[model samples]
Target: MLFKESFSMAFTALLANKMRSLLTMLGIIIGVGAVIAMVSVGMGVKSDVVNSISSLGSNMLIVSPGSTNRGGVRGAAGSRTNLKYDDAKAIKEKIKNIDFVSPSVSRSYQIVYGNQNWNSSVMGVTPEYMSIRSLEVSTGSFVSESDNNKRNRVAVIGSTVATNLFGTTNPVGQNIRVNNQPFKVIGVLESKGQSSMGQDQDDVVIVPLTTAMERLMAMDYVSSVNIQVSDANKMDQVQEDIEVLLRQRHKIIGGKEDDFNVRNMTSLMETMSQTTTMLTILLGSIAGISLVVGGIGIMNIMMVSVTERTREIGIRKALGATFQNIMMQFLIESVVIGVIGGIIGIGMGCGLSMLVGKFGNFTTVITPLPVLVSFSFSVGIGLFFGIYPARKAAKLDPIEALRYE
Candidate 1:
């Protein structure tokens, strides 16, 4: 009953100064709202990165030619023509736990179909390349073994390339000119969208490895070799096996450095996830500074409120109200302000996240955890800030307070 009476008095006091109470709550509203929106953006980015990496394929590994140091001048990785189509064939033949291997040679080319022209990346790959990269054909078929062996002038277009060249017409079985060389269109790849690196995955064409090597690039060396392992758990073993096999084939004996670099996609995924988690925390911390500022505002206003009601405190004390009752009344008022602000802030934050996702062309996820944390933190801030003023109000001398103006 005493607690109820104290809460009733707190409600009445706040009602008497509605504008002042609202002003005090504004800080908390902004603070919680900003924190929520920022965290949502961070989480959304993390989710997108994971999905993008997964789209590349599971249990995947990439082997690229390592850099070479010539006369103390080091060139970048893939600057050396050390990796070849033969090396890729050797790995597939010798290694265990290997599902598929595709040696790739890529170059940018101008594709012409009828009067329409579009510039896109042209990749030389085998039929196994389709499954390794998780690429599905929307129509027709990918490069067959016969096409690769015969070095047929056949091509498989990506969704972006197809749209640019054929528009509404089906591109399958049509002839498109790549680098002015006539090639028959065999397939169109399903849309894979953009990668995490911001490169368009569906803005390219696939041709037979033999065709790319002999006709298009006129090069014998492959740019890289992509391998998909049979099992995710054997990735480490498979990577080691490939490294040893390559080193032996290249005859890098007696502690010599490898001429190739191997990368595991699973490891890359973990590293990216950790990086995104740290970024999310950093953003959330920056936004949380406002919550601290809001606490300060609440303390300042509560102090002023205590001073304004000093005479009222005296009258309550004279009427046999205890010091605990006086303190509880002021504390409840501050907490009420915090609770209301937190609710309003949560609503505003959700709306802001949705708007950002729609207008900014970015993903924003409003998880329940962040909302709960913000509300609980706001309540804590109110309790902490309300302490000093409540104590001061309780410690006031009844005689002195009664004599005041």
Candidate 2:
């Protein structure tokens, strides 16, 4: 028989038992829908993480104090005071591919302006911190080199601090008390909202590095140093160079762990991306299990179909229908069920993903690749599951099948 004739006959048989065909396709529908929705959610979360990391800055590196080991136990990372202002200054001067550098110290303090007060992180940094951290002033200006050199008590406040302390008032040119030490607010930084870790990025106050170290915190060592690389390709080399320079400056010898750690933000971003990609794959794989179950359901239904149509198979064989014709007919019926179910599932998944994004407060992304994959996989499942039953129907003996009750 012609392939068209086989397909037409298969379609007609399914229509004869419309309810049963619909029921048989239900598993595939649910399976495909689940896979699509799960994958979209994973993609959305990955996108959010990438955006959060990108917002920090481009081609950036951070140098922080490493742990100190006294007697056999080591302190937590960044607990030591090994990094100093001169170390940062030397890095800016000696390191190649360095765009900007900022040595910083931080402490939490209660900031009071008029009758309002808020607790926020106060960081001591040079003017170069602005460019290195991609911070912009919405009013006034950032700290200057002269400000740090003179140990001026000036500050640049973040949006959250501004709101909590000043409330709808522009914080520039105002005076605020940091730990009860009055400092003039020279600028209000643009809002950065939140980081990937959900910390409020805008709840900060910036001051001159000298003022913070000498006046506010009364400390000698910097907590960390920020570096901005001029080129993306130079990040790794620069990180290594910074490690070498810092080791020399700190007088650390070979075969010993350094007192400072150099962190490449690009590397951090890559690590985060890899983690998110793995999670996406894991979720997709879990959701894919349903598809296999659906395929099994298809096989069971096809087997039942063959058993019910045994007499019909015998009659067709008696009427000159070849084995290939019988096999193709049954296979076409199963494939048609899969194709129709897959199309419906795709629509259902898209709608579900949209709903989740709208009401679930989550970012959902639906790319074309997942949809195509799910559809193709569904079709393959149908063909695979239908093969066994189709073969059995084709191999039936006409004489015995016709004589059986």
Candidate 3:
């Protein structure tokens, strides 16, 4: 059969030039390896982003007083003193969907335990902040309402903060000095990893907002406030309610922009997800160009084979071989190279992805859709690039091809 003849010819050609075949396949191997490695890295980054975002809390909202990159986020450094304790209380009491509210006050200073002092971030927050932010207390309790009222000199240390300040011993009831002010350790928080902005949440010490404002910082202005809605589905309604309440409380005139901005956690997470999806698509498309280049390499080599096998082509043509047979032969040779290379590339891709995941210490999802699509694209590349060369081989004149010197 024609198919048997073509396979026989292909086997003969491949065996006759073992080194050349391998050298040609090298391009495909490298291309596939790069694609897999880059994609795996992207997947790992996406996972990190999701975890970081979710750590902030799902039913939470952040109200910041600023614009630009600092807008709608915490840690606003130079914003006006627009937010207050009254606003937090109002949101908690008035907003039906809001379950909890916590005003944020933060500063960085040297904290001392015994003779050792280390500089770290310290935050002043209400009691409900522990629940809103899902902060767990490893020892003792978070700041109580009495502590807030009496301006109690008490602090809750993060796990890492505790380790740095008072290693191996219970920190509760022990006194640590912040900016030379003595505050008793009331609790140690469980470890929460980095935030979306790459800030380490574990390197912190928390105290009551009232105490921080009146005693430590000597200021009444809060940096931000975190609000948690009762239900995830009612997030937009809650956000709108908070906006209206804040604007009314601030007494802003009609049509003027709000001095404070409230941001929904669900919207923020969706935005991040959409941006990452676009990034993944762009990166994959760029990597696909390498597969096309590898396919071209196969086509170029097949053309040279056709040139060298002119006598064989002429003999087949004279012995009743049709143009379709010649075309099919060359087409099969090129496609075989692509198919074999693709299979090897897939194996190399998976192996290399695992290596990247291990060394990078991040998640790499080898999803089925990407692999299937990538393989199909590679095969298409082979077929499209092989057309011109295959046609040239098929159109040869029997007399002239047989008489070639």
Give the top-scoring candidate (TM-score): 1
Query: Model 3: runs farther than 4 Å from truth?
Result: 2-11, 67-79, 318-324, 347-365
Per-residue alpha-carbon lDDT of candidate 3 for residues 1-405, written as tens digits (9 for 90 to 100): 369988788767877888877766666665665576567667667777888878887688998765334435565383478888788888888889778889989899899999878889989988888888888997898999899999999999988888887889999999999999999998988888776567788999899999999899888778888988889999989889888998899998788778887888788888988887777777777777788788879888888888899988998899988899988888777776766677788788888889877886656767776777776766676677777788888899999989976
Model 1 off-target regions past 4 Å? 1-5, 67-78
Clashing pairs in 2: none
Question: Among all windows of ten consecutive residues in candidate 3, which has the lowest summed lDDT?
Answer: 67-76
lDDT of 2 by residue, 270-309 (tens): 9988998898888878888888888888899889989998
Q: Sorted by lDDT, highest first, which candidate order results?
A: 1, 2, 3
The lowest-lDDT stretch of 10 consecutive residues in candidate 2 is 67-76
In Å, residue 307's CA in model 2 sits off its true spot by: 1.2
lDDT to native, each model: 0.91, 0.89, 0.82
Q: What TM-score would candidate 3 get against the native?
A: 0.87
Error of 1 at 302 (Å): 0.7
Which residue pairs collide, candidate 3?
A: none
